[model samples]
Target: MNLVPLDLDRDLELLHAWVTHPRSHFWGLQGADPQRVRAEYERIAADPHHHAWLGLDDDGTPLFLAETYDPAHSELAEHYPVRPGDLGMHVLVAPPTRQRSGVTSAVMRAVMDFCFAQPGVDRVVVEPDVRNEAIARKNAEVGFVEERHVTLRDKVARLSFCTRTAYAMSAPHLQPAAIAYAHRRLIAKAIAEFSHERLIEPIAEGTGRYRVGDLAFTARRYALNHWVVDADSLTGPLDALDFIAGLRETLGIPEKLLGTYLEEISATLAGTAWKVTHRRESAAELVHADFQTIEAAMTEGHPGFVANNGRIGFGLQDHEAFAPEAGRPVRLRWVAVRKDESLFVTAGDEREHYLAELGEPTLARYERQLRGHGLDPDDYRYLPVHPWQWEHKVTVTFAPDVARRSIVPLDEGPDRYRAQQSIRTFFNVDRPERHYVKTAIAVQNMGFLRGLSPKYMQATPPINEWVRQLVDGDEELRACGFGVLRELASIGYTGDAYHRTGTPGAYTKMLAALWRESPVPRLAAGERLATMASLLHRDRDGNALVSALIAASGRSAAEWVAAYFRAYLRPIVHCLLRHDLAFMPHGENLILVLENHVPRRVFMKDIGEEVAVMNDQPLPAEVERIRIDVTDEIKELALFTDVFDGFLRHLAGILASDGVLPEREFWALAGDCVRAHAKDHPELTGRLDLLRPTFKHSCLNRLQLRNTLQMVDLTDQAGSLIFAGELENPIAVFG
Candidate 1:
């Protein structure tokens, strides 16, 4: 059984049916209308003490309702002594289903499992109608001991309690079917992505089956244009580490890369296990949740990458506190760095602007802390550091700075932040309108050691300003509703001639921070924000987030697709054609501004690290560093490779798989968006033809497979690219 948060609005009708059924006389609602049901549940939803949930079977059918409440404030509290960790709950199984042996017991056990899973929940208390012998017996099966008789609002109930130990001893382990299902899905992803990258070859066995590693691995055709690895072929229970080990030789993995890659795979599996054990919200409910809540609740990381959630440096406890998937709030550790040894840059009025944003009282407190250490406030600046970095990397790796009094730890700031999808960047949850702080840490994830380069920080602000000015000056970009989230300021302190693990260029990136303009202040009235990654989000029930947004828009799926392409794709193509510019338009780098669930515009970010200019065109000397010389033949790859192959391919795949928009139609719409931009710019007619925008398939997995520790040589980014020949461009068919 799957236990999930109850979405009252979506499940109101079904709940009303269950509550008013003839067998549900104890529920006390026999003649209720839709309005009555809404009013009643809305009250419960508003109360901080009470919460409801729905349980579903493997097939996604709702089978029961479970309500949990704070027993300290509950009706049962008046009757029984409430312990510190006690929780009150009520359960209602759907009617008319045969009460077979172990059926009700199974549901009760699942409910108990969910309750105990919560932090600090040591015991669960329940009160069922005394006449309900069946429910009393079900509770006993799950280790609930009868405590006493209690009078609830409208019924006499048999009070029972189950301690955490009793529940753990009596409850069943996660069924083998569930474990097998998770393993099959993960294995399928590994095989499909590895095959697509041309790292491993799968032998077709005809009739929709394929074998890898001399038939040691078998895959069967599955939905969503992918295959499912058969769990039965494995000699024992499925283990991701063992499975990868078996395929290493066949995939031609080197010794070093293979070991690190296995570490990443292990981390990813651990994260998946935690999610499977704790997730309690259905896709439909998640789709309707508030924007930031949805961002934190996302289960999948990158759809294409196998070890996307590696989070190599994080310990198990750190993962819980800092990982975005954990959805926990973090308080960043602040430090004071000596200005004589640090670098600082700002875009706008630095003192007045920042002081106003971060209240004067806060700034004064930070400065006073510096004076307390006998350091002049004039010689120092504040720096925000990740808590985990302070504990692991900073305290140990940057010990010299600490010893020399160059870096002094300060008290934690008052604001609370949530780690965004990118582990280093944080969104200001305490004050939603504040700028996001992107900090530096030495952690290896997704093919790179994710650290902010001190030199890179120097050019970030100006590059963002240059891009912002370009967008502001272009009539086409304005017409297409393009905007930019600028990196307004940056600060860094690097130790001279530093080296860790004897790798060159890795040491100088140890300490740095930047503040990027938040999209919140720029949002127009009636417009809400969501990450572009939502387009690729598929819930556990196989419903796509984009599809849900389209439904909410009340527009036909095709209309929504056209609007998205116009807002997103057209701006990207125009930038490439007119300015020889491109951005890392990957899902995480762009934020979609939605008005009534219809995408209106997009804000581009990650400019310094990911944006590039691919021609010899003259630019301001200060910003000329953004330019990268590329062969004229592949310059258009700025668009075809970055936007199309990198981002649109996966989005189109998701939409097509869900039947929201056919695969052919999705590419056709993209082609139309590009052609429309080309037609609007007659001056660039010759340039467009020379830059025939067909994509070569760049193998992202190959980069990791070759060097999981540091996938790309940062100094030679373009030269480090690995490609698996070419794919027939999906949009080429349109031309």
Candidate 2:
């Protein structure tokens, strides 16, 4: 039985059917005609707390009138804590099919699911006529824990109330969180596999506590300012930000610099919003909406490497096949490179969000749909996924860790040794000879170089047909998925330094594809959570929850990450930057190192949560592993601006003295970052406000802001000189 919100406009029709039936009471509209029943339903619908809906059997036949309400909304506000979050519930099962044993029971389950889903709902109560002892007893069969006869709803009726715990008792009927997690896990996997992947699913949904299938993630999503928090530490919402602010102040950094830092961080967070979504009916919605459209866009023709299993390897496409500029550099791409210039794959952005809009039901339905989809009824996975939530997906990649001896050899120069940070990227289905294209420039800080981060592809053309054949009827995707993984192990991309064990990136991409399919903002109260980090509060239970999360993450990978930071990264930062490298450059572009082929051991946490904090409170245990979040792009840009001016000058000085770097190669590394950013993002047009005459030298180009970056260069005519020649005898102004 599906008990969702009632369409008041159609209530009278259902009421007429019920009243004319064999068992229903006056609810069937006997004394009051159909019009009167419709009028009453409309009246209740007008109020937020009162609602009426028809219960539908599995076959879509309307079985009963399932109505519910808050006693507080019925002139009984004084009886409850109407402090906004609190809610009270009342359920009335009206019928032609009154005591059909299982009908009412099923309807009651549906109502319970709805009640528990109201955000911050504390308790739900149902009022039945005190004389209806039969219903009072039936409530127990339907899983009502605290059923009692009491006055409620401004009426002298026996009332039944249920807490979250009571609602959880129907766990067997709800969808398991593992399903939602599988979706999220796949999203992260797709991001690793595909290009320009964003929105790794949250480690946990925005519940009061932790969730299952929450893989290796340190940052958590609990309220920060809980009254029950212990005084020994100020760890919660603003813990990371507050720590960074205090660190800067204690170190006595000039506010002039701090202002820019704060502004950039704020803007980045504001621009790149984090999001979370859990669709209970996503599978059905996809089927109804034809999700296969995405598959067609990504992989129609390419039959990737045929494995020993006899199935052609297939991967997701970056875009549509008929798309313009088929090989244009995009976040992700599918290509068959006959030669360097012949690389091609059906490619284009799949419009997934639009489809989602057409398929998704209202929030009230989402809860029922989710629960209905799950095997367990009490599982909160049935709850709507939190939209626009903060999450961090850390990518671990490392090349051979360079000891000091190794570093000394690379330096092969004066006390000042130089290393550049470069990024190597690729998309799905490649050949043996295609090594990562080395970018033209590098950052002065070796610490900022990223060797590996979560990356993968193959969302389209779902797993090989052979795997589908071998994995079998029930194990189709799962068995095939595990089998291919073993093959990946053979190729050195699934274990240890060569690879790591985790969900395939295809899952992550499919999720993003799903999000893109439904991009509209369907939020309650129209709040899209405008900021990446919003300040929230929790009670004692919430505080304990946060503490537990912190302790868990801290004990897991957090300590290992922290230790890695100290071992290889810390000394290099201090020894290299005698000028005092601010914040260890780990916001976005600032955190990276090559240990194996993967970029591993990055420590970027505890920065910029509290803007006005003035204490030395210890950092929260949650601030451990950090990665490129929504704000990483802009924050990293800010980090880039911080070091560009000084670092470029140093590079020019050394290159000039050594005279080994080609003129073009020398200038290549100078402003390559900003240049690449400009070329990639056309939206920043007219935003480049470079310093006047700062256009000639890459040094000044590096210091400009997005709103102020001019992409022009400047040089001091008399002092300026390019490689292979000197300036004119007269004053040569740089421009």
Candidate 3:
């Protein structure tokens, strides 16, 4: 492609045809006459600060129109401060004669290259209309960081900027230094988690020195078999692939699964490298940042899993467009499925919920689309799908349904969503109060294919409703503001061909989604939301976000942790002993509501699949699937392994390493919280032992290592757990 100065007279007809097309409505010149187009270009030509260019192909055919101006002298200066060397840019691709792949992206890259090539240009500014989400995503592809909305002369626009350094880092390949840095950090994590699980025991060489194979590192042993490995002190191959390969025998990874495991490791390394190169905020800055900002700023994923970020099906482009850490806004693709072939369940009026989720205008548009396809709107239900899943899986695997009009593809939804750390769930960034849409994608991530079982989704809402009522009726829970983000609705499409296979696997579980309640509406005045995973976040400079939050709250580290336990741990304990219920309250599965940077309460999510009634508690017929029979010993592991070893041990290690709090004090505060809760409810004091000396060590990496495809049976998770011998309960000493 080539860029040349656009001639107002010679290019007038071509430019008019391109800008006046209906698809170019965002260009703000739709239905304009040729003369009107000429007047606009003439004004730009007369101005010394602005210039227009025509992008042409090898055959000299016009492909796109580009514009550049000096932001200091433009209308943008009125909204925000403009730096010296800031260049403003706009690009509009010509209406396509046929469907072409990567054309718009190519044109965008060309425009970015042209702008940065200017003599004084150091940053490129763009103000795309806020409603034009397609253009906003395109802008983000080239590394534009969105600021706030600015009112321009014609429309409200999202002001964004891209620095030369950021654009370079957004490239597909990482710099050598970044790759090496990511490898060292990942190698350290692998060593730590593996040793903790007793997969590869590190030989003690000297004080705080250990050797794994030929690799040597300095690490401190903490409570609950935790290893705090120092990344800088690690010596040997810094490549995560080689590191995993060296321990394949000891990890007990089968020969057939080794290659796939290595692929996961590579993907994890690439993701870490991208985050290391593109991180924009420090730990302190994230302390005051908004909810989504702190969420995407999280660097570590599932402190236990070594290959936690192994999005195996995503290509380089998908990583940039959908990865949570990428911080890109996404628009979900909507589809209409025949009512007979789909199931829709809700806790409230379905039509009213749909109208709110997809505004009235969008709902009307979708109804019109169905009528155009010669189908009645009342005969079908609407469902949202991940764009990647729709393009890659639905279009091909469900072709029979598409061809028969059982599943008709509609346009993208208007609201923009951001992928959460869980990857399948999305938060509505455009409308904060809207429900979180969790879609199914048949991509293999950490331990299993990330697909929602449509059969199981049938009872999701009822299970959530049951749990909601239980929490509301508990006096202590209501006082603490501990609640759940209910999975209020669900919809799933079953294809005829795959449905008859009688197999329950990824293929059968492809097209399903659930709507979970958003935490935004539950917030009080002066309160903010942050994912509990942010507590484990350490910035590129080795600063902990949790430590920063403690300092901001004007409380000592011990005091802040005590408050956190009240908000987070006490509820889980209450539900277990008081209600005979167990929830998978891992960091990613929880949300913390904060005021003045101190956690006041918590919200648990991912309910239908993760929660269980461990004992013989009577449940509603619709929610009976959650009932699980387990041994008393295994029931105790719910707190000992999941809460203590899985989550708090890691938190203790981080605080101790940062010198903010001692591990002993951290465990003591936790014990005090549990004891205080027991004191308040005297009848529940002896129901469960909180100070057990030891509990079976539940191994997470072992599950993934055994079967990278499907780690555990969803229906019998507790029965399928892989366990190492035992771990000493950290809080036992407090008793």
Candidate 4:
């Protein structure tokens, strides 16, 4: 492709046709005549800082239009600080006469190349209309980082920038060396996690040397049967697909699910490749970064599941548009659900409070839309929908309802959100105080189809209210500054087809949303929020974020670990011993509020789906679904398997590998926290044993390997747990 200076008289006809097309509505010239189109370009031609160009194919045929200007002299200068070498750009591809793939992307690359080839250009700037989701995604594909929305005279625009380095890092082709490196790392993790689950027992050749099939690697076995494998020492094929296929029988992967499992492994490898090739910050930089920055920088997904990022329904474009690592701002799709078919529940807030979250303008606009449809706004409730879900599932599966106006599709919400690491949940980046909106998308990820059950949605807010009261009443929990982020409101639309069948399958759970309290309002002075998962994040260079936090805190590694235990682990133990309650306290389920680079307290979330009440305590009828009858052994595994083995074991390996803290010392600090808690509550001491010599080994990957669709029945979690044998408790040695 080549760029030629646009001719005023000759290009007028072509520019008019391009801008007047419906596809170019964002250009704001949809009904322009020939005279208007010519006058606009004539104005640009007269400006010293603005220029227009026509992109031509090698055969000298016009394919697209491009514009360039200096941001220092443009309207953008009023919105953001203008750097010395900031060059603003705009591109519009002509409506295609034939279907073509990669044409738009090629045009984008050529435009970027043309801008950088100029004498003084170091970065490219764009202010596409905020409603143009397509261009925003394409911009991200070429490394544009969405900064924020800027309101202009014509429309609200997303101000984004792309540096030369960022463009280079987002090159379409993956580096061969990077792909090899990613494969080696993933293979090592697979071996470690699979062996830890006792699926493929490695033959012990010598101390620290083991062989799985023909692949030989060195590893050290730690407490909880954890395998810390050496990525550099693996001697066999580094292909994850071939490795999984070879061990299919040993891993007990069913023949029918083998292909799906392999696809997940490939996707995981691709995600890793993207991370390594991108411009990732160092651990020290991330330690001082903001919450969302730390969230997007996470490379590891679950730490235990090998195929953690399956995301089966997401195509490549979906990954770029919606994935957390992409760091692109998203605007949720809104729809009106008929009040009779939908369930809306709230903890204590009224409907007006939830409606006010949309702000007055959006709320008024939505109500107007419902009236336009000849439907009463009072008979409907507005619900947030994941953009992907709106496009893929709702439009297709609920076509009859939409046609009958039972589910009326509305425009995108005004506020921009960022996808959290959990993928389905979104954080309000535009308005930090707004509640987090969690929508259900029918995508298969991790061990189940990621959807919110309407049956569970009915009880979500009440369960959150119960848990909030419990946390508020506990003196020990309050002393540690521990709290729960309540899920205040929820709305779920049950389809007529599935509701009549009375089966709460994935289909019935597809259209539901919940509003949870944001952590932003809970921040104290000098305190910021970071996901607890950030503690386990390692940069591409192998430096641990936890190590960086310790360095920043001006404290010894042991001191920092002790503080972390006090803020995180002690409250978890208190909840279990004093309340007979257990939460799935994985790193992703908790948020750490840090003051001066130290964890001052924690706020637990995902309360409704994860929290379990083990004892047969009397509970409110509305919140009785959380109650579960389990044996003492299963209740003990709540700490042994969920907390120690699932979360802390990975943290221990990260710290040990970084040489910041030894493994033994880490568990000793944890044991000290537990003993202190036990001593404070003598009546609860014998109810559960924290220092048992061994605990049942609950295999996570085994659960997925056995059944990828639904790993375990949520209703019978205790009975569905897959266990191998037993693991020696690291805390037992400290006792």
TM-scores of the models, in the order given: 0.77, 0.27, 0.80, 0.79
Q: Model 3 segments beyond 4 Å from truth?
A: 1-173
lDDT winner between 3 and 4, please give it. 3
| Regions more than 4 Å wrong, model 1 | 1-181, 205-209, 213-238, 495-504, 688-695
Ranking by lDDT: 3, 4, 1, 2
Tens-digit lDDT string for candidate 2 (1-735): 566677756556766666555444423345666777677777878988777777776447776666666665665554444444445554455553322323455566666666677677767666656666667665655455543445644346655555677555533222333223223323222222111111122233343222213222222111110011112222232322232345454323355555443343332221111101111111111122211121111110111100001011111121111111122222221111111111111123222221222223432343354345442212221101101100111111111211211101110101111111111212111211111111111111111111111122121112122222322332212311111110000000121222333443321211111111111122223212110000011111112111222233334323322333343233222211221112323222222221221222232211221001112233232221112222222232222322322122222222233333322343333334234334544554444232122222112211221111111222111122221111111001111
For candidate 3, the lDDT comes to 0.90
Q: On residues 62-100, what C-alpha lDDT tens digit does candidate 4 reach at each position?
A: 999999999989999899999988999999999998654
Question: Which residue pairs in candidate 1 collide?
Answer: none
Clashing residue pairs, backbone N/CA/C < 3 A, model 3: none
Cα deviation of 656, candidate 3, in Å: 0.5
Name the top lDDT candidate. Answer: 3
State which candidate, 1 or 2, has the greater TM-score: 1
Model-by-model lDDT, in order? 0.76, 0.29, 0.90, 0.89
RMSD (CA, angstroms), candidate 2: 27.6
Better of 1 and 4 by lDDT: 4
lDDT of the structure predicted as candidate 4? 0.89
Model 1, 570-603: lDDT tens per residue? 8988888898887878888889888888889999
The regions of model 2 sitting more than 4 angstroms off are 1-9, 19-22, 26-30, 46-49, 55-60, 75-84, 90-102, 131-134, 141-143, 151-156, 172-735
TM-score of 2: 0.27
Question: Candidate 2: worst 10 consecutive residues by lDDT?
Answer: 302-311
